[model samples]
Target: MKFTRTANANWKGTGMDGAGTISTQSTTLNKAQLSFKTRFADGVGTNPEELIAAAHSGCFTMQLSFLLSEQGFTPEDLNTEAQVTFEDGTITKIHLKLEASVPGISEQDFQDTATKAKEVCPVSKLLKAAEITLSAVLL
Candidate 1:
């Protein structure tokens, strides 16, 4: 099966003065880019890397949750943070940190499942250039 999303951006002016609109039609990201500072502090449209981080984090967490459930463990909570590092003018690494509380699951089991999830998740598979690293903590 294949899935896809469409987004468009329109920019004007220079780096400091330019602004853009990021839209996904009528979806959540429609016309959503008035400012795009690194952390949205300078009033610029959101950048691609930031959007990639958001997608990776959400996708990885859901994949981990599903994997845990399939293993007959109930996950109390799953927290994930994805750091996208850029070097030499391009994205170089994706660091993933996942913390999950799965009742009735051993640390080893949890870690194993997390490893598989990271390998098999759609976003993880899509990112070939960036190095993907993961840290899974069980509680």
Candidate 2:
């Protein structure tokens, strides 16, 4: 099976003075604004790093659920947070923090699955160039 998605961005003015609107085919993010101040400083708008973090967190949570089900467990809840670090105009690292509640699983097994999820998730594979770290808690 194959899938495709698309997002477009339109910008005006210079880097520090410019502002852009980002739109996705799904329209979930309809013309979200992005600017240098938003990316490099505290400003109102969405940035690429924030978008990546959202994608990674969602993907990782889903992957963990799949792994748990494959291992004969069912997840009651999974809360994942992805932290993207941008330094010197480069994405340097991504940290995944997760709190999960799964029934009928040992802590060690849960941890193993979560680790594998971080290693094998699609987003993790795509962002392999950056340093990725995970801290998972089985609650």
Off by over 4 Å in 1: 34-36, 39-45
**Per-model C-alpha lDDT, please?**
0.83, 0.94
Write the residue-wise lDDT of candidate 1 on 28-77 in tens digits. Answer: 78777754463335544567777888889899899988988888888999
TM-score of 2: 0.97
Q: How much is 34 displaced in model 1, in angstroms?
A: 6.1
lDDT of each residue in 1-139, candidate 2, tens digit only? 9999999999999998989999999999999989998888898889999999999999999998888888889899999999999998799999999998998899999889999999999999999999999999888
Candidate 2: the clashing residue pairs are none
Which runs in model 2 stand beyond 4 Å of their true positions?
none
| lDDT accuracy of residue 100 in candidate 2 | 88
Top-lDDT candidate index: 2
